[model samples]
Target: MGSVTTSHELFEVRRIAIIGAGPSGLAAAKYLIAEDSYEQLDVYEQQPEVGGVWFYSPEIVGVTPVPHTTPRGPPELPIWPKGSPAPLFSNPMYQHLNTNIPKPLMQYSDQNFDSQSRLFPSRQDVQTYLIKYSQDVRHLIKFFTQVADVHLVSKDGKDHWELTSRSIITEEQKTVEYDAVIVANGHYSVPFIPAVQGIEAFNAAYPSTIIHSKAYRSPDAFKNNKVIVIGSAASGLDIGTQISKVCRKPLLNSVKTSSELKLEQENKEEVPPIAEYLVDERAVRFEDGRIEKDIDAIVYCTGYLYSYPFLKSMEPPIVTNGRRVRDTYEQLFHINHPTLAFTALPQKSIPFPLSEAQAAAIAKVWANKLALPSKLKMIEFEEKRIEELGDGAGFHVLGFPNDARYINFMYDWVKTANDGFAKEPARWGSELVHLRERYQEVRKKFVEAGGQAKTLEELGFEFSLKY
Candidate 1:
């Protein structure tokens, strides 16, 4: 972590810039707008509209080659002639994707999913909900503008941010200064494909034979082909199930451990991680010495990297190994420079309401309505968290009860700073925590019953004060 001297004087943040108009960015905007202190608020979104990754397009970007040893940086921007279309960045949403978390738990604190939405909302449904939520702050967003760089600039012995952004359509570039910056840009863009032996030769022999989930749109092209799906995470399980239906019998599923092979479907066979790829034989050898030959395609459902090419200029780098962001206190504020904050970095938890909680804390702190702990204390908190969670992706994971506790912690933190004037963020009670805990089980039942249930009560699940 970087070190900085702590000052007792509060830094007056009047102008703020938020990157990415995703769920977290929208939440940040809502909370910041609610505070009457900020003189100007701007949101930079690369996409022409909001919804972030939920905004789906049929177009698929070219896949990064297999055996990616280092973190993948941002794609180079093309210089398009006037009136030419801007480049498209693909999201990792498949055709049949549905929310794993139930609607009640996935929704933002201020709004509800539509009455017609299913228990596990589809991609379109969630996109619609986010678009609706972003209505109030739409004016603050600069669509089709990509933030190219954010670096610290010193003026009057205080640190400020210089943001440079490019217009995706016109290729025009501009630079601006802000008192504070909120990095709500998501971490799900760059795909992380583990390095495997002979992967480059295999790709050369059979081009497009391997792909990350980010490039996958549908299983139609994989029909009747011998497929191997890598990783046992959420996308792996979902995409494996979908591919198994149309592909050959006994789809090879590769996982890190026996515990990850949860699905017991006959068409899917769990195998150990890949030991090597035989380029000549079009085969893969598992760690258990099992070999599968003539494989048609290998889909890496492995997750994405925590990439921020725009913040590359910052000293004491924020991202390392593409697994975690460093120097963050409570996984939100930058320990050395509190003005530069990040939200929606944690995984294995619902994102909507969690983003609201984080945004509330950031909004209050920047508005001088909330006071953060001293720099030394904040550094101590980071050190303590690293001791408990280690220094990897686990540091950002807030699973089960920990996630619930975090939400309430932020809610209470904001309340303490409030003078009964600021808007409150989400505070999960016992009833909501119970719902969040059992949502996976309830979703399973809903799927088994042909996914006809629209509400939790329809599936025999209801909220109770007592856990």
Candidate 2:
């Protein structure tokens, strides 16, 4: 219900509609407001609340907690009130849930959490952090509005967009126009439930036990009961890891969850070639051999698929079969749809603070180009590379081959994006360790067995520093 834009904010913005009030959308609003760039910015988020996907958890069955030994990043900042509405997922998670990312690496370049914090912050703690972020920039957000659809509009010879939205609180539909829109509405809104045979029949025969990991809040859902968790992604691991110590034998249907080939078990070496198909033709079964039919619960750690209903008509959809649209020059902006950008999406990595810095770089260049600034029109290899990449080839966010993941700290990637290349800002600051150390100590270890080395030379990195 808050937006930083006063009645007179000295912005040329017509009217902008942001479709989600989560981190990315809120971040964008902060920039637009603090930078005094937008004339009017209104964010629409369904569910009568903010924190979209992190909104709620509904219990069904088989979802329980086990020992939580998963690696973590930093804690989340809670933005929601302690006494929100229904939706058990809305309740605070157990004390053990932390990010898969480490604290030092995930902190924004401009700020760091208190030094006395844990290595990775808990989900609730991080939510509290986001709440702080929201408070700091509360004037930039509007909650309880869900965007239904948007249509492109052309006036005279110029193009603009008309957005259609419904205020859940007011129960009123409204229309607005904008010069640009940033769809911070992320993927994972809908669960990716697998279409395994007999699933529907199994549900009919034994209703209410099947559910997705998103519904799981705590082990309270599975006390003195056997549980089953599917999917092998981070969430799957987190949930399964938690439920394992509790569930009699939390059966898992290991599949192509991780880009890497390692399957980690507590106190066990990472396993390889994870079983693609469960042996009994059933993802989970019970001991009585009731045709493998009944179970206390079945948690589909089933991964989520990225979707953009707005971009449905964009020819090659932005994502294909759980994979992103092919080819990105700098791996940031969409090749074919230059006006549209997916800032925080990753290929094989989790969310990190680096995304914010990267988003800022893209935004600067984008604003300059839109306003026809000469600084952006200059000649350079970086620009050419970006232009070449705009050809619609290599239009993927996961980088090439879709096998490995990489994050270069050079910041030159964004340089290639806007002016074709330039030195990163010293104000951007440096991490605890140099880029060389990151590569030698971190990057090299993540490569698959037969991967090739991608150094500054190959990456068009002209400068050198310690690793």
1-467, model 1: which lDDT tens digit per residue? Answer: 22242436587689999999999999999998887789999999988679888987567765676766455477435333356365556678778788888888889877889989998999999999999999999999999899999988877766789999998878799999998899988988878888888888999899899998888888899999999999887788888888998999888889986433344467898899999999889999999899899999999988888988999888878887988898888899988888899989999888998999999888888877788888888889989988998988788999898899999888888888856436678888888898877766787788777876788888877775321
User: In candidate 2, where is summed lDDT lowest over 10 consecutive residues?
Assistant: 67-76
List ranges where model 2 is wrong by over 4 Å.
Answer: 1-15, 33-37, 47-96, 250-253, 256-294, 310-337, 369-410, 413-467
TM-score of each: 0.95, 0.65
Report every candidate's CA lDDT.
Answer: 0.84, 0.47
- Each prediction's RMSD to truth: 2.6, 10.8
Candidate 1 wrong stretches, greater than 4 Å: 1-7, 75-87, 258-264, 464-467
Report the number of clashing residue pairs per model.
0, 41
